[model samples]
Target: MAGLRRGRRPDEQPPEVRMTTLPTGAELLRYVVLVTGVIIAPGADLALVLTSAVRGGRQGGLATTMGIVSGVFVWAALAGAGLAGVLVASATGYLMLRLAGAAYLLFLGIKFLAQSRSVAPPVDRTGGAGKARSFWSYFRRGWVADVMNPKMAVFYLAVLSNFLHPGDFLPGKVFFLALVHASIGLLWFSSISLAVGRSNILARNPRVRRMLNLAGGAVLVLLSIEVALPMQW
Candidate 1:
């Protein structure tokens, strides 16, 4: 065996080495599809976007969309920094985030429910005439809702690990995938916002608006309850 090994070329590579390259085109497509499915699934984020669009129109919905995307970038940065593992491993950290997120969702849901009963037209939360100020208000709500969810950190840590390999540059690849996720989210949610916002019939009809508010509020409240429950992860 020793003599045969010595006769072999020094430049010969092991089979394991063949698997260490960056994600192939097919792998990337698979990842994108997975991400899209996750984003499109009904969740607090979708509920929030629909409500914001109904209440504040396209600007509000787009602002909220940007906020959620920003949160996605933050999670990507955390993963790249290697902090996501710490979050996943720490029970206290996870519990605190879960509670805070649940509370925020509950509050938003109640507010929406209360507003649904009002006869007045939908108004921005800031009550300010400045478009920028109102935009920031909705934006901050979306950001807070996303950032408070511990599941995002867990998801990032879990999924990114599968895509990584030994000796590869971690941060760049993570960000690249994150960029794809964020781009898909932006496009998908923006389309939803525009479609909902441009509906003159829905906007003009109080009954329809009330029904949407009730639905959005109920979804948010149920999500909050779901989030508050103990997660197996």
Candidate 2:
């Protein structure tokens, strides 16, 4: 047996395993469409963007979108590194994250509801003098809202995993996919911001503004409840 093995040529040795093929053009297109649809769907992210746009105009909305995208990038990195698996595996960790996220969402909803009942329209306190500071404030709010939500981590771990091919270059592929997702979010939110920002009629109408605030607040509260409850998805 040893003599026979030694006699075998190198070409007769087992072939090296190959990496999975990259997604084809059709697959890429399908991914883009699916991701875009998900971004445009109504959710906490959309509600936040709409509220920010109406209150702070285009810059505020854009800043918020940037914050959200930053959170997505972090999630992608964690998922690619397989660190997100830890969160999924640890019941205690997942529960803590979920509770924190729910509390934050509840706080936001209550604040919005309170504002809706106020006599004055929501004012941008930064005015013309503190544009930079105002931008950062909105950015932080957006980032916190996204990062606190354990669902985002789960989404990356669950959904993004399907797109990743088995290979040594998995991290690169995940990051690239995340970039695409972020790009779609930016474009969608920018359009919403621009549209809402330019609508002076909607902005000036106290009744309309109040209704929007109430709707947004209610939606947020419902989302929080959903997060708090155990659901199989």
| Per-residue lDDT of model 2, residues 161-206, tens digit only | 6776655367667877888889999888888888887888766787
Question: Judged by TM-score, which candidate is best?
Answer: 1
Q: Give one digit per residue, the lDDT tens place, for model 1 in 58-131.
A: 88899999999889989899988888888778889888888899999999999889878975676645545678
C-alpha TM-scores of all predictions? 0.87, 0.86
Instruction: Give the alpha-carbon lDDT of every model.
Output: 0.86, 0.80
Clashing pairs in 2: none
Clashes counted in candidate 1 amount to 0
* Candidate 2 ranges beyond 4 A from true positions: 1-8, 11-22, 124-129, 231-233
Q: Give every collision pair in model 1.
A: none
